[model samples]
Target: MSRYQEMAVFAAVAQAGSLAAAARQLDLSAATVMRSVAALEARLNTSLLLRSPRGVALSPAGETFAASCQQVLQAVLDAERSVLGLHSDPAGQLTLSAPLLMTPQVLLPITLAYLDTFPEVQVVSQARDGMPRLLEDGIDIALVVGPLPDSSGFAIPVGTVRPILCGSPAYLARHGRPATPDDLRQHRTVAWTSAGYVTAWRFCHGQAVQWFKPTPVLSCTTQQAAIRAAVAGLGLTRCLNHEVHRELQDGLLETVLDDFAPERLPVHLIYREGRRATVRVRTFLDFAVPRLRTHPALNG
Candidate 1:
């Protein structure tokens, strides 16, 4: 006689088009389905269904009530999911993706910490240079750098990185540091190429607009290779601050033209549509956002 059970049975009967079929669907005796519907009709003081030899059909009242029932049922299930997400320690494999250079510096540490804290969750991380369609590709979360193009997805601002010019001490000692953007033309530079945009750098220096195209003595397709060449004093290069943080700390690299540093590169954590966020993903964001906010390697 419970209203919930009555409504559920009514919905099943309406959907299945017959008491026998509805009983089969609910795995209950046909008598049970009949009594539930009867109780429901009595409680409402209206006949909600029409019984015929051919099949079952909804009465005028039943037709209207069934639509309402579907909405109510969906709301109840959504509420349950919301509460479960808030209370439960989520367990499942979380798949994440990020650009190749960004993966090591930004995503890796957060992932390591997440695993240590949440032993129940497993991570599958992929490094790629381009963003994938989360719904189509089945990615749970992604770390993206720079300004994002307009699209449908949920995103939270995590951090920022500044693109700056850096060179080895030995290289600077031999060629001298570029005091101004104009000096870049005299230096042997390492070019990092990606996405078909090459030979352009943007900077600002005390009311002066400057752009430079370095004559490439060495060109690299990967950030690691570019950093390696710069570390070996092959040429001056431009890179995000975090990419050379360790090298800078170890005195393997020094930043030049600081006054002309480009605008901070924005970082974002994006997720797929209708994706139920688990505790593992939530916990990592909580811990990671704070650290990223204060880290000197990133722009505040």
Candidate 2:
């Protein structure tokens, strides 16, 4: 097999996690998929995968090689599409990652609009509370909120979202509203946790910053769940303004301690190095950046 064919087979097997699944995807026999991968290992003189009844797991070396293979394959596909003049009409699978709550409220609407404009493109979205390894997860784009670590990728500033402390009208009416950050101690809170530990609620005013570690009456892993709990009148919850915009608008929830809220968190649309960006990625950026930056909820 040619080097390109070998790389394609290896990448497929790595992604599918099983020879049988890879074969099905490639419309080749299971033995053929296995042989192609085995040939690649032989050529490299390194064990690429550990096969078992459950599935195949890449070795450390395999992980490194697979990343390279994916890049090469993508470059090749981009080249072909460019030559065919199809690059102007972006078409391919785009994998996007963002926080769970933001996916439904913010990201999904943008993606749906993008798809409407470019029907040829397909999107696969991954929603989780915490960051996922962009390269490992094969994410084409990520909508990240807050400070980003120094990295090779390009990050385009979209807008900002500030955390808002809010609760159902009924909950606030019964328990009374917190007038200041310090008064939160007397209130029950629905806290959002990451990796099983609740995150401290932070507030700021002028030069002062305060961290309130709430002994939450209810703790949940996702912001969406915490927002739901708060809306159900369980307790007060702190989340991004965009996450609860509809509820706040409909009079289901009301914000408190607005005077002490922290500075707005920066929102960014991140992707790999610009030189490596595919047509779909660039197109999405052009399509999304202006809209996101102008969004009232994100900008406020």
Candidate 3:
């Protein structure tokens, strides 16, 4: 294999922390990653990685060489992107990630439009539930639904979503509407157990936030089930406002305690690699940002 390919393989191994993990990231076999590293080390006349049954760690030389490889590869990529041609159309593959529920309704339309606009570009998007390791997973960009983590990467504000409380009209008619957080105790609840058994739900009133623990009649592992229970008049439930849009529009659910709701969750387009981002990555970000910022469902 070429020195360029070998260096790229070694760099992937160093970043991923294991040959198997690196192979998975690169879509190569474990044996191929091992061979690349071995060949690179033989050519350099020094061991780069310390091998083990559990995983691999960089040797002292490997650490230094790994840094150089990253810099060199990045520089090469940047140069290639810049030198492709002055009039050359943007053409490359981009991998993206978005929240699971938002993909179909929110991101799908934008993606299809982008494909129509840029026929030379290929796209692969994964519906992810939480923040993904961007570099390790080779994700070019992600649409994050909550507060952005510190130094996660560059972010462009999109909009916000509220954690809303809702119940069927029938359920509300029987249980009475909860005007305050304390009234949650007098009602049946359907709890989403994705984050474990949720005993308490938090709400904001005036300028203060408080938690109200309600006894749940049903505990569901997925949000869809919890929402379904609420729609069937089983009990009240809490979920993001956009998640229940169709149900609310259809009169299957009605939001309660809006005055007690906290500040809406902020959304953003987050991407790593900053200035080193490829032409396809940069092009997609530019194309996607304005459209995302104006999304009605995502922003309050």
Candidate 4:
């Protein structure tokens, strides 16, 4: 097999965690997939995967090699897309990543519109609550909310979202709306947690910021789940304005302590810096930026 094919198979196997799974994904037999990975290891003169009946686990070196393979494969794909851009109509697959809650509320609409406008383009979107490594995840673009740390991507500001503390009308009527950030202590809360620990709820008053680490009556990993919990009259939950915009509009939820809400979080469409923009990416960005900036939820 060609070096590129070998690397591609290796990367596929690593991602799939089993030879049979990778074979299924790549439309090859399990033995062929195993042999390709084994050949790659022999050529490198090092053990890459620790094979077991359950699946294969990448060794430390294999982990680094897989990352490199992904980058190389991505570069090849970019080159192909650039060449294809010479055509009149853009036609290619575009992968995107964004927060889980924002996907349905915001990104999905934009994607559907883009698809309708560009018949030849296909979209593969992944939504997760945690930050995704764009390169590692093969994401062409990422819709990120809140402050961003130092990165090599070009962040284009599309809009802004403010965190809102809200709960169902029934929940608020029973527990009473929190008059201040500290007043949240006395109310039941639906909290978002990461790694089994609840994250602190942050609020602002003028120039001062405060945090409340409430013992949640219900804890969830996804913003959508917490919002649902709050809407079910379980307790108050904190979420981005856009996440609960529909519920708020439908009177299923009501905001509390709006005066103490923090400054709006900047929303950004981030892509790798110094990379050639594929026609699909450029077209989608041109179509999406303005719509997102003027979106009702973000504006309100």
Best by TM-score: 2
Top-scoring candidate (lDDT): 2
Evaluate all candidate structures by whole-model CA lDDT and list the values in order: 0.79, 0.88, 0.85, 0.85
- Model 3 root-mean-square deviation: 5.9
Identify the superior model by TM-score, candidate 1 or candidate 2: 2
Give candidates' CA RMSD values in order: 12.3, 2.6, 5.9, 3.9
Candidate 1 residue spans exceeding 4 A from truth? 1-87, 195-197, 273-276
Model 4 alpha-carbon miss at residue 9, Å:
6.0
Candidate 1 residue pairs that clash: none
lDDT score for candidate 3 against the true structure: 0.85
**Against the true structure, what is each candidate's TM-score?**
0.67, 0.88, 0.74, 0.78
Error of 1 at 173 (Å): 1.4
Backbone clashes in model 4: 0
Q: Which residue pairs come into collision in candidate 4?
A: none
After TM-score superposition, the amount by which residue 226's alpha carbon in candidate 1 deviates from its true location, in angstroms, is 1.1
Residue 23 deviation, candidate 1, in Å?
A: 32
lDDT score for residue 57 of model 1:
95
